[model samples]
Target: MRILFRLVAAVATVLVGQTAVAEPLTLIIARAVAVPDSVSGQAMLSLKLTPDSGKAFARFTGANVGNIVDLSINGAVVTSPRIAEPIRGGEIMVSGTFKPGEVERIAERISAGDAKVEVDVKSE
Candidate 1:
């Protein structure tokens, strides 16, 4: 009975220690995507980019698309394309989060369709 109590106490101590440590979440690009449009005479493909920040992690979801190597998310390229595609789907949802302790809030704008859209990203 005494040995059993000791074992339980040791386990509880370990669990408490683990919880005391604050582990921040990290962001990673899971995949690349492509998007096509009728902007030009040809089926022009421009990635539907979503610039996100301020969270511990961010998400990027989409199908492999253009030769465009990376998605410049609020001035930072957090994702890269595996291959190029003309007509793609669900690529705009590619998710990415700011690196733990690396994300900040920034005031910026980006070209969306034809208008400059405002954006907020964690400053470096």
Candidate 2:
């Protein structure tokens, strides 16, 4: 009986190991162009992330996955706090707020082509 229990435990462990809840997510910066429309309220830019596959319940352990998000631009960058939410398949919704003149600032950065964005993600 003890041997049987041990075998069962081993099998369970193997199965669990094979199916980790977390996976590396690719954050591709789509377009960081500036928007000067008042309706959008400034500091607005078009952006996107790719290959988003993971379970929200699982933590973002830095062990398996290295970094969280990476940002690269050819122009200015407007800093703000962005939020990502799970979408259809392998996608997430990312939005944030920026400074009043954030859009113009980003434009200048991109024009200079010396600005790149990088973000880090780790286990909670």
Candidate 3:
């Protein structure tokens, strides 16, 4: 299964203009729900890590306190927010200026269990 978890955007390397530029780490996430943004009053996507994944997330966030966490959609970085506290509840709110129909697509993909573990071989 693809590893998906909330992350504090740690500085990393990216080759740009023949130079290694520091870039925000791509935060792979599991499931997110589409909703209205609370602050901006715009479109938003709320995320909640799965049970098993949440445990690991708590531990990671606990260790990496006071860092910026990034959110990505379709392999593109959308938001990078700082960790205010340890996310024990596994709930995250993602709000951004998205293109048309982007929020619906994310919700659909998650609801359809796109992030779940895939089985290549079936056993009868």
Summarize candidate 2's per-residue lDDT along 1-124 as a digit string, tens digits. Answer: 9999999999999998872334433334333466544665545554433333223212333233432332224322223222243222422222356667665676566445445543333333
Backbone clashes, candidate 3: 1
Model 3, 5-122: lDDT tens digits are 2222222222222322223322334676788766776778777767766666666556545666555555555666665776787666767778878877877776666643210111
Q: Which residue window of length 10 is worst by lDDT in model 2?
A: 74-83
Residue range with the least summed lDDT across 10 consecutive positions in model 1: 54-63
TM-score of 2: 0.37
Per-candidate TM equals 0.24, 0.37, 0.59
lDDT, model 1, position 74:
43
Off by over 4 Å in 1: 1-68, 89-91, 96-124
User: What is the C-alpha lDDT profile of model 1 across 1-124, one tens digit per residue?
Assistant: 9999999999999887752222222222223233223342222223333333212122211122222334454445554544343322322433344333222221111232222222222222
Residue 35 error for model 3, in Å? 1.1
Best by lDDT: 3
lDDT of each: 0.33, 0.42, 0.56
Estimate candidate 2's RMSD in Å. 7.9
Candidate 2 regions with alpha-carbon error over 4 angstroms = 1-30, 36-40, 48-95, 110-112
